[model samples]
Target: MVQSQTHTFEGKTIDEAIEEAKRALNAEMDEIDIRVIDHGNQKRFPFGRSRAKIAVSLTESNDETWETWLDNEIEDQDLFDIPLSPDEKQPVNTAGTAWIIDGQLHFHQTAEKKPILVIPYDGEVYNHNEKLSGRHVLKENDVIDFHLETTLIETKWTVKVNDKEQTVTLTVTPGKKIIPYIADHPAASVIEPIVQFDEQVNNQLQTKDVYEQLANMEVIEGIDDAAIHRACSAGEEQTVTIASGKLPKDGKNGEMAFRIDIQERSLPYKEKHDGTADFRESLYIPSVEHGEVLAEVIDPLPGEDGISVFGDVLQAKDGKPVIIKAGSGIEIDEEQSAVIAAQSGRPLIEQSGLLFRMSILPKKRHPGDLSIKHGNIRFIGDVEITGDVNEGMTVEAEGNVQMQKNVMHSTIQSRQNILIHGNAIVSAITAGQNQAVYDALQDIVPISSPRTDLLSP
Candidate 1:
């Protein structure tokens, strides 16, 4: 038979003794279930020791499993719902604020207060919905009435209850209405009319009434001398004083009723003539020897009336008066004057043909000696090499390639034609393979493949 394990500790009260037993068993309050089997008589106990008997029920298991279960129970008991005061608990208002005609809702809140509202309407409403069904203009004495329903939730315990939802209905009747005046069918001011007039003096000269009477008038009878004299006498008195140079003062005496006729005068004609001179075969006559002859004709030939002569004067074959030079030469007639001029040298005439020929070739120096290298060299024109090149060098030219030395492990390409005048070794030739080469050669003479040999050792 197994002996029952009984443990007891004395304290002033049952709670104190049960705490002592819990400490002895190394069990927390949540891990064990305590049952009081006997509350010992307080009379029989001593002054400081009150007798209490109890049994603690706990799971019998390994220390690790027991500790794990005890830790989970402690953690679950630690969480609790904190209580809120009456002032801190309030309701959320769901009805939105009011709005004026052609106006929007504006909200103002203090630091301790929050304004949140929800609106219920007849249609499906989404966030940021705008309503434009009301009248834009408000008239005087107009009433705008709306109802606001605010829901408030007041709690009795820490746990929230849905049945305690309360609503407060608010009816807002806006104050005295003032209507804004909007202009409709506005009137525009009329522009003033402008008047114009034309007159010779202060009186209107071209009057319609006077023109109508003159339109019917005809030249039926000529004016008499007495009538003309009478009309001239009635006019303003005027005196005519003629200038001495403008009018002829030495006119015939007793001449009356003078008449003047004006005519345009014609100008005198002037003619210019260019004298012809030939110096192709004329011998050089010094200026000192022919000083007088030069001086007489130095003014250059005048208008079309003058004539010029050059070179030796000889008779024509027909025996007419003539002059002859090495080339065709002629003289003027006896009525006109002819001038003979002498020149010192023959005139120069420019020849009209090609002047010079030139040829261009690739530079024939090493890259180290020159500013540029000839690796994968391409020429727009002919390529003539006068120096040596290292192995794995390439040359592409449009016209021809005339190399004085050997080209090894290189390439040569041309579009128009190619002529190599040196030995080539281990080189590849790719030309006229595709339409791309022909297309690239339209403006640029030749398109050459890249020289992979340049990267070779």
Candidate 2:
């Protein structure tokens, strides 16, 4: 039996009319054969509606009375192509995006450009399947319906189901099809089905429902869905940090890290005769010996590593090394990291870059008393005191000390011998007490001449 179906359409030309029928019937050029029945006249005056008629029928029989079924299909297609009434035969579908109309959330890099949607499906984020050119808002679990105009793609497929052949209509979409495909109407853009890349979501992305953008084949390619899933699960500023390069730390000049304790050891001001406190004088004199270590350098630290958001590695600046120059009567030991005195003398660190050395004081005769006028003495070499050491004063020497007058109510310390021609008197101060008594006298005599260490001036 021959199976055939007929339909008609009006356009500016016969081809345009036929093309409209093809779209209405949803048929490709090769799928059906057409015989022109009539070419309707155009308006002899101005632009008037043109009309035409054609008979369409299948060409071959792929299966057998499926041929009759094909005839029935043709008749069904012809009925579907015609509207419910003749006046409404021509139906128009305006092309654009469909899903954006009912969307709950929307996003874009800039506020002016078209925004992508983050749709929630089964507790995860997805993008708009439609290639949205403008703004659209979508929310989680919003029921979206893809109309035929928005979702239909030009595609055809067949599958062997139950060991028998069955025609399966395919829509152009992103999914697990594993086949070459285009849409039912390939030119008509489609809204993608939302996809969930992660179970958890990032806070920044979550606030905007942007866990994942529905991947569209036309706009974007090679989307790492798994990577997007991992990013979403990271849930915040958990993205990779760019590696920061290390800077070279400038070397610090070596110096003594230890404190020169002067406050605790210095003498406090006290009252003199008439039980009145002078409240004026306090003294300190620091002394040192030969081969003594005064200062050391600290260990250098290593540089830290840096990283980038894209997972690139960066280097950090390392701490630089420092060297301390030892001056006269001083030695530098690299292994010990120390500046040591070569000989016994007053420990002196010079003004030049924290270098350490020793200084030997010179013997001098003074006309006046060794009181506040001379201040406190810190001599590294042999010292001579011609006048009496007045009350509340300190004289420290690394070498032997020789005095012409007695030391009264003063302190005198020497690394070597002490020679005093007169008495070395010591005194005590008692708070709220009546009397001021002198302690034992200190006197020293040397057995041999001493060696002196001095820095060259």
Candidate 3:
């Protein structure tokens, strides 16, 4: 006889625990037998903070059988699969036993310690000064006393399951107390339990009661019985959207429609290559040509009505209308659906009027480098500069910027690439694409570091 190795491990799930055991023991499926101690459950999604346990031990595959298999005499019948895992979660809730939680009352007794007490939520009892089983609500100045002692204790459970039945018993030591019906708790199947678990769970829900809360309740065909059964078995407290009143679905609001290809200029950060974060593409000035339709205001949609759970009719609010009429070089379409371009210019859409309006402005020009003479140029069209953009100058253009001289120590923004004949030095230049900008500064070295920030690069 050979002594077999044994070990126990825990994981977020049973499969995980088994895999951990396999890794620790370095054994194959045929070489080990796994006994699941506890099939743990999660309280919610993505991940629930709970654990499961499993026991693993080397199988009793004797030496003689192994020798026969090693001689190439093994057949497909030699392999087998084992299945002993829970299909879904089955929690054992402890909510019903408390009846009431986190409440206090005035005690008339002079004793220094008060016994742990639990009472029903709806039921009532007489409130006497000495009795702990009364129905009186507690408030401030309530007489209470207790000697605090913190002791760590282990919880134990014994589970027995069969094709038709599943039973769970919780045991507490030091006090030697055992409570059966772990599957019978009111909160057991908080999510959904399999139909096989129906016989095991206690405190099942009543569907008729839940249906009463919803107005114009429609019977969800096919899976209704199974869903309700599973929900009841799980003892879930979360509001069942299927069985509740449905609120109105508000209509889609009217919007100024535009294409993403034309509006993807202002980037949050520059993408990285090897290890550097390029910040070049922060400047986005949306521009439009003389004959281009920069924006179109779509029509508002009507809302859909909803029914309350209590059979009340809920009103649906309609989407508000927006007006895009005001602006030079831009005019409303014949159908009044869109704001069309009258002449070439950049459209400035804003919500200044009761609804919304867009204004189009003409081209801009900076005679010399940006200075106090220019005073922060913010143009909605193409821009041209005759001289270098000197220190502390800020220029923003909705269209392309054509610079004749080097840009230095300033903020230059453009929706399209800013074509510069001279070097770009010590300035934050934001543009749609930086590849052209990189090519423009291919040989230009920094005159001084000057804390320059090149965005949307």
Candidate 4:
């Protein structure tokens, strides 16, 4: 037979056109030269349908002699016109795929360009009682079957019911399905086989299978069917919750929010522009005017009950009530649920367990030396010491601290200002007590040197 040196073919896609060329030339992929004339447009179809076209020719290295062509009378035949024997046809390694969309079969690939799949030719696959073959989109409820056979894929999973019996979860390691096909042989590529994968469970799990698992675990309440379906079809390793239970919400505790510095009763220091402590700047003293509101009371709330998947009721705790008492220069406003100052001085709070007392003092005077007889003086108002403070004596005041005589081997702390008219000998005196305490804390951890771990036991 005398065949043309080159020929052109058209198909739905470039791969299909090449497959046709290979069969016409009776040659392998390497034995031919192919030029893509046109890549078919799947879109803009019907009115402007474009089919993929390719030009194929045998390579110069082809030197095969046709055994029966010389004896035949056929001559000058086109490449496609030449008749092909069963043995002469080459294998075509292409196949079509199918998917279920909106409860209907879709023969073509999805928009995501997933691989085209072909259902294996089996008696099980049917479209309304008729055996199906090739690519065909069927209506809903149409069964799609194919033999999935493989041994290399691995799948493992575990179903866990939470200790509270409030949830059910599945931890799965999905497996893969490998479907083999032959290219040139048109028959094998068309009829895809369907078989069950040899594993603990197939990666392609059904929603019903998951529903059965949840039923076995006795998770009847709040069973999320959608979540179970998504997990079954994910075909990847993941932990998914198939059921859930409501949780109990605890009540809020009662609280008292102070608007002023009644807890610490300290003065705040000023900082320089360069972020350094400016000791020259006077610290701001925290004091309340008469009738100023000190704190607001927050009411407690009752908690809500919850239910478990096993139909068990979970009880919740109620919040506790808060109380506030007025001390010297302070009054409680029951109508506003607030603590108000009766006289202006310095606000203070004394706590004994859950009970709280709010107070304010104007000043405290000392007649003589601060010795063992006088004991240590701790006042929220200004303090005036007439005589010297002996060794081991301590004096702390939220307002100004004035010393008339010498202080020796003693400690004096004032939140606002410290005025010493007499000499302070071997004494530790702090004007801004809060700032001094903060500075002392910083010195405890030296960043520039190897330091010991104070927290280590």
The candidate that wins on lDDT is 4
Q: Of 3 and 4, which scores higher on lDDT?
A: 4
Minimal lDDT window, size 10, model 1: 255-264
The backbone clash count of each candidate, in order, is 6, 38, 14, 16
| Candidate models: Cα lDDT each | 0.31, 0.43, 0.49, 0.61
TM-score of 2: 0.31
Candidate with better TM-score, 3 vs 4 = 4
Q: Lowest lDDT 10-mer window, candidate 4?
A: 448-457
Tell me each candidate's TM-score: 0.16, 0.31, 0.31, 0.42
Mind sharing the TM-score for model 1?
Answer: 0.16
lDDT of 4 at 259: 71
Order the numbered candidates by lDDT, best leading. 4, 3, 2, 1
RMSD of each: 46.3, 23.0, 36.1, 24.8
Per-residue lDDT of model 3, residues 219-274, tens digit only:
32212344444444443233222333456767867766642123313445545577
Error of 4 at 183 (Å): 10
In the range 1-457, model 1's lDDT, one tens digit per residue, is: 1223556555556787779878887877765566676676657437744467777655343545543554465358732122345775732221121122221222222223323322323222122333323222222222322222222322111111111111111111112222222111111111111122222111111223222322333211211234223222322222221101111122121101101111111223223245433211121111111111111111122122111111112221211121212111112122423222232111111111211111112222122211013234543334556554345555554444555666566666655444445666776655444354435434432122211111100
Model 3 alpha-carbon miss at residue 174, Å? 26
